[model samples]
Target: MPNKHLFFLLLLTAMALALPSYYFDSNSIRFIFFIGVVAIWRYLWALQHFIRALFFLKVKFKRLRQQEQAIGEIADPKHIFILVTSFRIETDTSILVYKSAIAEAIRLKQPVTIIASIVEPSDERLIKQIFYNSAPPLRVSLKLVRIKGSGKRDGLAVGFRAISNSQVDLESAVVAVVDGDSVLTENCIKNCYRFFSINPKLGALTTNESCELTQSSRTLAIYRRWYNLRFAQRHEFMCSVALSNRVLTLTGRMSMFRGDIVGSSEFIDRIEFDYIDHWRLGRFRFLTGDDKSSWFQILKDGWQMLYVPDVKVLTIEQPPHNNFIKGATLLMVRWFGNMLRANTCARQLPRVVMGSYVWWLLRDQLISIWTSLFGLVLAIMGGLYYGETIFYAFAFWILLTRYLLSALLSTLHGHFSLSWPILLYFSQIYGSMVKIYVLSHMYRQVWTRQKTTLKDSGNRLEHFIRTFGSNIALLGSASIFLTVVAFIAGVLTTYDIQAFISYYFS
Candidate 1:
């Protein structure tokens, strides 16, 4: 669901459609023209992200690997105030996240405080237990500031209030918002401080979200594993890389704000309004645009956001087989909402249009969807002309090629297992179908929010079919076109060779 995967899917679709088209009709100038336009636009956007990534990568690469180089390092760990937003911390996952963060805070030996927001109104016992369990000295100082509310925004607002009310000086302390489910690495705090010290322009630093899909023994762990790997390896880190200037959102999962940055009345205004009204009424808002909203605020305030890859955390992914449909559906819905929200923010913040970033984001989304639909139509047309066998064969070839490519990429990246190729294949099939359903579902959700029916738990399969059918059809068309090109090439080679022989003999 990350924009990275969406772009990758778009690129794959574009390649499948455009590459084979060269063989089918060399003289089709319009086709070539369209392909060129898409390719150029994609390259420019990628170039921006790539440049920023390279800069950070080079700095980190030298710092960690090179001993001779006196690269940036945190001499004195800055005074940091940790803000963890949680409804209740009784859950095993929540407890573990707190423990890890506490351990890291202790490791850094910095003054840290935790403010947990009690979101469930009826779960007084749970909240009490959570406070009782997390009480006192793990390493650094800790406080359990409980707020009365039942939503993500409420928790966030509560946390913000606690920080504001606390004696901690907002100007000097590093204010980091760590999600309840995120586990920080040992040196995460150190790396974050280091990033802040080196880049004075950076108002915030976000740790790379190192997520993994885990479950009990046996089942689709392999699939979950690969999915998480793809997500973390690329998407999780992309926001920092891609949105260097015009950051739309700072993720709540593992993002750090300078004490001064969030402590400001301007930045505090973010916690003031949830969506429409103030934070209290819309506290339990179901929308997942919190991160996007933060990014928008930072950009509006003219502060840059930095990403420290070394500051890694293991964010747990929702298991795929158990909750695939619900999970995927939620993902698509959230993404659609995020985009809509981002568009609104972009309009308010016209600086977003000053660069290629917005264009890249919008262009890719529109064209990618178009490519998927176009492929489906072409495949249906090809089938009507050629036959069913040809269509099926094309599908098989497309699947095979995708699996091989993904397998190779995973192997090279060393993030996925040997079995990743097969999982990638299934993901392709399932993801495509899910995408199609998502496209339709997104439209419905956006257009007719009031009359929306409850989604079935097992809707991923249905969504997968809707999404993948178009992809299969497109691949089929590409295959038929490739086949025709192969035939033409063979005939032309034969004719040229015969002509050459006849001329030589004469």
Candidate 2:
């Protein structure tokens, strides 16, 4: 996702694309050509996003001005609902988050409802204290919805349902969904809410996010880079996707939606109970990634989602673990699990409804898990059988290409990091492995911060069978991949494979 990240991507694409006049047989050329073609196609895909993102920046600025003018002519949504979801959050963080929400509502000077969906009674008391201490207007009232520490999804549903039962007019109201740790910047709510009123079809919109880490023990600094790099990539991708009036996911950190959409019973149900019936996995329920569920439902119902690049949200973060690898792995497992679970979305909905570009984006999620590792496998095999020259060529290509690409990437995010190249490779390679594992064991889900997890409910024997089956699938897939690499690398011939098969059977 980082700019330098594309170095290996494009490098492999060139090797894959320019198959050239290899001395090997047609099969080898065909194999290389096929990989090249996929790489080239994705290379263009990323390139298109880059070009569109640049144009989108200008369009976003112009559109904001136009929207303000439009609002002056017509009335914008006067009623606002702020849904804040928090669980086991620190007291100081609770104060910052609740105060920020109150400030946003007070600025609007409209009849606003602030709902705190929390598990702790102390949080409720803290919020109430903050609310009265600010001396907020009578129009800005507070509501507390207590949950039994179930999860974020349940907390959100309870909050939304409470809003739907209120006296406000759902048709003309706008609802802002914010995580408890996320603090809004000045005019953050005001900037996005006006867009929903002017654009009738705009279902929801999310603001850009920046993060701050509180508890540091040396390893925390790497997470700082990780979060920023991810946020930077998100800013670019969201802007690019928003050009088509679609975003891959509506971030849970801070997003605003048309009240009717968020208030509907169907929408609440999607958040509460989203599941899939995979051919191999059978039927499994989702444990996380409620945002993806929300996005899918909104898009399916023929609504538009947008990204406001200018406005930002400040997210308060803590290190997931003292060991960076353990923390990073846990986070990726959750993220990629959400992605692989959302893979079937393209087929479930009508192609014409979601548009071709959006449909392909969902499909790309499925393909990327494999393609992310394809070149590495080829490079390793080529080194062993073909020659060391092929391996070193790949290594040298990475060094030169990443060093150059990283320089250009800094212009995109307005900052430069000497460590961008190393971070990018770890994200791509490790992220791919995590995706592959999650795809096989789609039933596993975890909330890293809360230490909550959900698995298929079964007895000891059934659980063993499930674990064994997943391991077999994972190892089996790896074996097939290596075999294919052997043939492609010219280490195994057609006769070699046939003779082996015959000998084994005999």
Cα error of candidate 1 at position 154, Å: 0.6
Question: Which numbered prediction scores highest in TM-score against the true structure?
Answer: 2
The superposed Cα distance between candidate 2 and the true structure at residue 23, in angstroms, equals 15
In model 2, which range of ten residues has the least summed lDDT? 16-25
In order, the Cα lDDT scores of the candidates are: 0.54, 0.81
- Give one digit per residue, the lDDT tens place, for model 1 in 349-417: 554432465445544554454443343344444555545543553454455455445544443244545
Candidate 2 lDDT over residue span 1-506, tens digit each? 45655665576566645444442344675335334554566567667877777778876747665766667625568688999999878888889999999998888866899999999988888899999998988999999999999899999999999989998999989999999899988878877787876777889988898999988787887998888778877887887888888888889899889999998999999999998887766677888998888888888898988888888999998878889899899999988888778757545888887878788888887777777777678778777776765665566445544544455456667876756667876787888888888878888899887788995588898888777888899999878877876776677789998998899997
TM-score of each: 0.66, 0.91
What root-mean-square deviation over C-alphas does model 2 reach? 4.5
